[model samples]
Target chain A: MDLSPSGAWLVIVVASLGCYALKLAGWAVPARWLEGERLQRAAVLLPIPLLAALVVVQAFAGDRALVLDARAGGLAVAVVLVLLRAPFLVVVLAAAAAAAVLRAV
Target chain B: MGIGAAVGAYGLSFGAAGVTAGLSTLQTCALSLLLFTGASQFALVGVLGAGGAAVAAVAGALLLGTRNTLYAVRLGTLLPVRGPRRLLAAQLTIDETTGMATAAPEGLAGTAFWATGASVYVLWNGATLLGALGAARLGDPGALGLDAAVPAAFLALLALQVRARSTLAVALSGALIAALAIPFTPAGVPVLLAALAVVPLILRRRRET
Candidate 1:
């Protein structure tokens, strides 16, 4: 929230460049090196935890405190929708709606 | 076409989320245009929106983007572009395009890849702009429960990647670590520490070998 406008722009530029570089590296690097089982496993395994961490931090944490409010309800709905194999947009919107409804009541 | 439409709709949320996270609309659009990766873009904005430092936000996002490289590696072999065209191929080598390309009939793979990538790019960027503008006008994102939407989006992305018991185990561990770390550590650090969840798996594998 305290982020300066320039700071935000810097993040946009740096992160975007880093991501593009990673994508290009994939194309340039030899397939044999990346195709190794261990390296491949690391790649596949890495994002799983990061994403899971994000889910927890976003849903449960509140400014260095774990406080569950409407977001939890929203996330619960998201879980259910995901289990039901709902579309990506549906899952996200349904979660938001669930939270809004919970907060309203 | 259907994939593009679905992804485009999701882009609306990204745009809205970026604004909610405190980015100017131009900054948000810049992310969609330059980063072009859905989960990483969301992670960056999500971290920034939550008041995390820019360094942490960039770290989390860059980590998330690494998977795109893996996608590119496979696509490089399958498609085998030679020179400057490789730049376009690498840029378009995202999850959706890779999925469509890999799944297409042998003769139609190239067509499928280009069509899906280009269409999704257009639709997603257009929708991101729309969502960002609409959200900027809405006022009070909490009233609409948009705050919760961020986590929900992450959950959806996470759900897609969890197919094995080990991956699920890792996910749960990551969640626990992040939740535990939140109260003690800084905002972005918890997510970074959560990546430590893999240590147990690594140790276990080491023991087996």
Candidate 2:
């Protein structure tokens, strides 16, 4: 009952179209509208919160209940690497290794 | 162009996760080619991987995608692209391309955008296929801790953007909202609703100056 092939394809199609529409809509927005501080601030601030939410959800989700295990350790390792300004690949591998090692023990 | 491999690495994780989440390999590759943003693609698969409803997955993905619209708006003034080229520019308006283009000297922004975007597209799609094909052999990404890749990747991305005080505040509040909602809401709903946590701060800043 998860995303089937057909279902996955549908989401891809809709997401592509919707994403394009957002680009077009951005152009269509009047310069006057963007002149408003609130509208502009919301645009800038939106991803910060949204991506944080994604990080939380992805780190903790488990079988319809929230739990933390190796994933948290992985996320923490990622935080340290990222703060150290590790390259993107380094951050990913170290994080995966951290999680894998934690799960192994 | 060298940075396209960033997309490659990110795409590989998505491929593994998408397949684990029950999407076919073709389906996962299609996502990389079509939707083309790492965060949104991850949001869509993260939900489905958890066996959450498809509607919830779509909702979360689309909301995350709205950020691309802001990127589009920011790029418009810089690029001045029009007609068919505008569409092409829009497709290329992901984080890497925008960051590169924005950082370029005034006249080179367009070149930076295209070069970065095209390289990412080619490498990312190819890596997606590789990951999808390899997924079955890899067993559970969760066991390998590949599941943690999703959140860790998001944190890495957030680390880049959270330098500003306002952004850090929004991120903290958003995390709080999502953490609180985890017990009460469905799997993907916390992410979608967490948008509300930032609204007041945005509105308040508007009132401030």
As for candidate 1, its interface RMSD to one decimal place is: 1.3
Kindly give the stretch of ten consecutive residues in candidate 2 chain B with the minimal lDDT sum: B1-10
How well is each residue in A1-105 modelled by candidate 2, as lDDT tens digits? 266667777777887778767766766675565656676667666778888988888888765567979989999999889889987778877888899999999
lDDT of 1 by residue, B1-209 (tens): 57766787789999999999888889899999999998889889988987899899999998888888899888876775889988888778788998998898877778887888898888889999999998899998998999999898899889889999999999999999998899998888898898888777876776787
Q: What CAPRI class is candidate 1?
A: medium
Task: Please tell me which predicted candidate would have the highest lDDT against the true structure.
Answer: 1
| Per-residue lDDT value at B43 in model 2 | 78
Question: lDDT tens string, model 2, B1-209?
Answer: 35766677777777877787778888888888888888788878877776667788877777777767777777888887878887777777787888888999979988888888898889888988988888867887767877777788788777877887777888989898988888888777888788887788866876888
Model 2 lDDT, residue B120, Cα: 86
Question: What is the DockQ score, from 0 to 1, of model 1?
Answer: 0.79
Every candidate's fraction of true contacts kept comes to: 0.86, 0.71
Maximum-TM-score candidate: 1
Cα TM-score per model:
0.95, 0.90
